[model samples]
Target: MTAQRACGLSDLVQDEARRVEIDGVPMAVVLDSNGEVHAIGDTCTHGDISLSEGFVDGDSLECWAHGSAFSLRTGKPLNLPAYEPVPVYAVTLDGDDVLIDPSVTLDVN
Candidate 1:
C-alpha cells in the first residue's frame, strides 16, 4: 500500500472530521464516535459538496449539504439523495502520525 502522511494524530480528535487533499484527491480523515480514524472520499456522491464540512457520528458521516449519511469504514450510502457509495481509504496510525493509503479500494463490491 502506498502511504501518505495526511496529518498528525493530535490534529484529529474524537468525533471530528478533518479535510486533506493528497495527490489531487480530496479526502476526509474522520475520528468517529468510536474513536477510530477513518479515511473516506471527501466529496459526496450526490453532489459536489465536501463531506469534510459535514457532521460525524459513530462510523456514519452526514453530508451537511443534503443530510445524506455515509459509512466511514465501508463508504456505503445510508440515506436518500445518495445511492452511490463513496470510496474509502485505509488509515494506519504510526505513533503520533496519521498515515493514509488513498489509492486503496474496498474489496467488497
Candidate 2:
C-alpha cells in the first residue's frame, strides 16, 4: 500500500507520541527533539498497553506499564519483559503532512 497521511506535522509535539490508526493498523507517531517523525507499532510486546500512552525519551518510546523502552528507530525493546520488537514504518513528510503506509514496515537492523 502507498503512504497515507497519518497526521499533520504541526499536530505533534517534540518528544511526544500520538496514537494513530491507518487502515486498521494501530501506530504510535512520534516527533523527536531533532524534528524527525517516526511511526511504530502501538502495542507493547510485554503488555497489552498502548505505546502512545507511554513516554518518549530520546529515540525510544517507553512502555508505561513495565518500563520497556522501544527504539523509535528500530522498534526493538531495550529492556526485559519485551523480547519481541514492534514494527517500524517509513515516514514521509509532505509539506505539513506526516505520511505512512501500514503495510510497509522497515527492516531496521
Candidate 3:
C-alpha cells in the first residue's frame, strides 16, 4: 500500500479528526488520546452520515447521527444500531505529517 499525506500533524489536534478524500474514498483521520493516529471510513455503518462530523472521545469515535461509538483501533462498533464494522485504514506518522493508505483497509476476517 502507498502512503499519502493526509494532513499536517499540527492541523489535527488531540481528540480531533479531519475528513479527507483519498483515492476517491472518504476517510476520517483521527487523533486519539493516546497521541496515536487512526483512520476509519467517514460514513457510519448505521446510517448515511460522515464520521468526521462526529466527535472523538479518547479512542471511541461517535457518530453524530445516532450516537454510535466505534473503536479507533479495531473499527468495531461499541454500541447498538451498528453491528458491522467499518473499514479502517493504516496510518503512519512521519515528522509533522499524518499519512494514510486508503487503498488498504482492515480485513474483517
Candidate 4:
C-alpha cells in the first residue's frame, strides 16, 4: 500500500504520542523533542493497553500499565514484561503533513 496522511504536523506535540490507525493497523505517532518524527505500533506488547496513551520519554514510549519502554526508532522493548518488538513504520513529512504506510515497516535492526 502507499503512504497515507496520518496527521498534520500541527496536530502533534513534542514528546507526546498520538494514536492513528491505518487499514486496521494501529500505530503510535510521536514527535520527539529533537524535532524528529517516529511511528510505531500503538498496542503495548505486555498488555492490551494503548502505547499512545502512555508516556514518551526521549525516544522511547513507556507502557503505563507495565512500565515497558519501547524504542521509537527500533520498536524494541527496552525493559521487562514486553520482549516482543513492535513494527516501526517510516514517517514522511510533506509540508505540514505526516504520512505513513502501515504495510511498509522499517528494518530498524
Measured over all alpha carbons after superposition, the RMSD of each candidate to the real structure, in angstroms, is 1.2, 0.5, 1.4, 0.6
Measure candidate 2: CA RMSD: 0.5
Better of 1 and 3 by TM-score: 1
Which stretches of model 2 miss by more than 4 angstroms?
Answer: none
Per-model TM against the reference = 0.94, 0.98, 0.92, 0.98
Off by over 4 Å in 3: none
For residues 54-79, could you state the per-residue lDDT of candidate 3 as single tens digits?
99998879998999998888899999
Q: How high a TM-score does candidate 2 get?
A: 0.98
Write one digit per residue (lDDT tens) for candidate 2, span 7-103: 9999999999999999999999999999999999999999899999999999999999999999999999999889999999999999999999999
Task: Indicate the worst ten consecutive residues by lDDT in candidate 4.
Answer: 41-50
Backbone collision tally, model 2: 0
Rank ordering of all candidates by TM-score, starting from the highest = 2, 4, 1, 3
lDDT score of residue 99 within candidate 1: 89
Clashes of each: 0, 0, 0, 0
Which tens-of-lDDT digit does each residue in 33-105 have in candidate 4?
A: 9999999999998888899999999999999999999999999999999999999999999999999999999
Candidate 2 residue 69 Cα shift, in angstroms, is 0.2
Deviation of model 4 at 26, angstroms: 0.7
Off by over 4 Å in 1: none
